[model samples]
Target chain A: MLEVRNLSVSYRHTWAVERVSFVLQPGQVAGLLGSNGAGKSSLIKAILGLIPCASGAIYWKNKPVTKQLNKVAYVSQRSQIDWDYPVTVEKVAMMGRISSTGWFRSHSKHSHLLVRQALERVGMWQYRASQIRELSGGQQQRVFLARAIAQDAELFLFDEPFNNVDSQTESIIFDIFAELKAQQKALLVISHDLSETLENYDKLLLLNKKLIAAGSIETVLTNENINKAYNRYLPVGNSDQRGFPSLPLLTNQKTPELQKSTRC
Target chain B: MLTWLTEPLEFEFMRQAIAIGLSLGILSAVVGSYLILQQMGMMSGVISHAVLPGISIAFFLEINVAIGAFIAGILSALLVVNIQKRSRIKVDAAMALTLTSFLALGVILITSLNTDRINLDEILFGDILGVTSSDVWRTVIITAIILILTKLFYKELEFYTFDPLGAKACGLPVNLLYFGLICAITLTIVASMQTVGVLLVMSLLVGPAIAAYLLVKELDRMMLVGSIIGAVSSIAGMYGSYYFDLPSGAAIVMIIFGFFLLAFLFSPTQGILTAPELKNKVFYWLRSLLN
Candidate 1:
């Protein structure tokens, strides 16, 4: 299990995340929802100790997260990577074993087997020799997924794994997420997706520099919570009767489905 | 052709120059591969110039100049990192500020302290033929140490350079790895200061590595190929310098650029002339102009 207590992150004296608290239980897939500049990335970075938290603590398995980094796996957003880097898909997968193989020693045969198994699981084994830059966005994401799988960590954090990925890659990712959850691994995914894909997550945490709601999708997707998270007030009917009030929540630009629904 | 090469070996000064040149060639490329991959090629330029103040100070203190150069080089790199982290200034701007400040300080100390033993022209352009036997040994030792360290930490360094955040999350000591890399780069610059001088050292560091980058898809292969390119350029440049009466440092830099041009124009996978897409684009443009 992972726990964040009164987490606060500041950048240049401005609050990015203020006093946000949440818990991620094992066997749970929680989707972290927030608009742009809503501190989702900052919160994740702070938890990973990539950036210093203003004032907060993160704990994993009852120990400080900083001391338990080996038990955690994080896949940053695709845009943060330099695809032009001169690494083969196989080599990138092999990097997951660097810590386990120890310093000043070559990778063990067991490490190679694990890397091969992870690449095969992601259906990227055939392109193992190709350079990373030659792959499409979906394939690139799959390669990172393979790397995460090879890490064999107890906690997984993904930032926008679905961005720019194809539908096939999307299904592959969901399948892996289901497998990880089945194995009792804790998972937190940051995503902008507010479509029917919300059903895939076991829970949702809505945020706007602070935690607005955290629970089952139906409970967190309330009209008032959505309006508060997005800072938009629409005079639509009561959200109770609306089932899943899929208001054009974050992006401001309405989805085609939302436009059709609004017409009715 | 054999006599031309053998004749230079007969002279002790020529032998020392050749030995130092070849060692520096291999050393620069190996260390330089990381510099270019990190998109911090100019950082090499910054550190090389930053060593000037350290050299002058070391002369005043009667210590080994290489020690001073290494310390100064590392300090400048750290300052650049500090400035970028503490403020909104980007890395390039930080590097520029540090580079000029250290270089100016070095110049002021050199003139103010009357370090008559230090030759400004030799420091700027290099005097390869004047190198002693000890200079040759120092270059060789630095090369061997750097190569061994790179081999021992290959996997960790690869992971750190490719994705620093992911490496850190996986519990790799990325900060230590970065400091180790900076130290290696600084040591390489200090060693090459006599062979190519600080002003032209960036070419030795970046040229062969980038040339190999155009043709290879993996880091290890880049290092291997770049070392060969570096070695060849050094040998050819030495021969040209001995026969044509040109400056040795300028000759080597020219040859390095010559090899880079060849790779840029004819590499199988990425060349402007060899890649099918670029080749067709050129032909199409010419045909349209003719019409």
Candidate 2:
């Protein structure tokens, strides 16, 4: 299990995230949804200790998250990576074993096996020798997914893994997410997607610089929560009328209920 | 051709100079592969020039000049990091500020102290033929240590440089690794200062690595190929200097640039004139302009 208590991240005197609190239980896939500049990435970075938290704490397995970082796996936004870096797909996957292999020592046979399995699982084994820059966007995402799988960590945090990925890659990702969930690992995924893909996550956490709602998908994606988080007036609605709760139309636009509502 | 090479070996100073050049060539290229990959190639220029103040101070204190250069190089890098971290200023601006300040201070100290023994021209453009045997040995030792450490920490360094956030998430000590890299770069500069001097050392560091980068698909191979290029360029440059009466450091830099130009135009995979993609683009642009 992973827990965050009163977490706040500020940059130079301005607050990017303010007193947000949430808990992610094992065997659960929680989707973090918010509009642009909503502090979603900031919250994730703070949790990983990539950025300092203004006032809060993160705990994993009843210990400080910072103390047990080896148990956490993070895939940053694809835009953050240097795609032109000179590395093969297999080498990138093998990087997951660096911490485990330790300093001044070569990777063990088991580590290599794990890396191979990860590449095969992601259907990138054939392209193992290819340079990373040669792969398409979807293939690149799969390669990073392979890296995360090779890490073999208890907690996984993905930032916008679905961005720029093809539909096939999307299904592959959800399938792997299901497998990780079945193994009782905790997962938190930050995404801007609000399609039927919401069905893949067990829970949803709505945010706009603060925690707007946190609960089951139906409970968290309510009309009021969407209005509050997105600052757009959504018509009042119940889960039964919409089949499943979806954010209402903002401004002069017609509500999603009036149009063809996307169903899972 | 063999006599041309063998004749220079007759002189003890010439022999020492060749040994030092070869060692520095390999060391600079290996260390420089990381610098260019990180897109901090200019950081080498910053650190190299930053060593001036340290050398002047060391001369005043009667201590090892290399030690002073190393310390000053590391401090300047740290200063750049701190400046970027503490403010909204970007890294390039911070580097520029630190590079100039240290260089200016070095000049002031050198002139104010009246260090007649210190040669400004030699420091700017190295006197490779004047190197002693001890200098040769020092360059060799630094080369060996750097190579061994690079081998030992290859995986960790690769991960850290490629994706710092991912590496940090996996519990790698990224700060320690970064500091180690900076130290390696500083030591490389110190070693090359006697061969190429401060001004032209950037070519020795970045030239071969970039040339290899154009043709290679992986970091290890890039480093290996870069080392070969560095060694050849160093020896060829030395020979050119011996026969053509050109400055030794300038000759080496020119040779390295010559190799870079060859790779740029002829590399099978990424060559401007040779690669299909680039060739078509160039032709298209030319046709459009003409029509």
Best candidate per TM-score, number? Answer: 1
- Residue by residue across A1-264, what tens digits does model 2's lDDT show? 899999999999989899999999999999998877789899999999998999998999889998888788898888889998999999999987777777888889999999999999999999999999999988998999998889888999998888777789989999999999999999999877666677899999998899999998888877788888877754553232432333432122222332221110
lDDT of 1 by residue, A27-144 (tens): 9999998667778888888899988999998999999999978788898988778898889999999987777788988888998899999999999999999999999999999999
How far off is residue A99 in model 1, in Å? 1.5
| lDDT, residue B167, candidate 2 | 89
The DockQ-derived docking category for candidate 1 is medium
lDDT (Cα, tens digit) per residue for candidate 1, span B1-291: 799779989999888988888898889899999989888899999999999999999999999999999999999999999999999999999999999999999999999888857987777878788799999999999999999999999988889889988998888888899999999999999998887789999999999999999999999999989999998888788888888988878999999999999999999989888988987888999999999
- Note the chain A TM-score of all models in turn: 0.90, 0.89
What local lDDT score does residue B248 receive in model 2, on the 0 to 100 scale?
A: 87
Would you estimate the TM-scores of all the predictions?
0.93, 0.93
Report lDDT (CA) for all predictions. Answer: 0.88, 0.88
Contacts from the true interface found in each model, as a fraction, amount to 0.84, 0.92
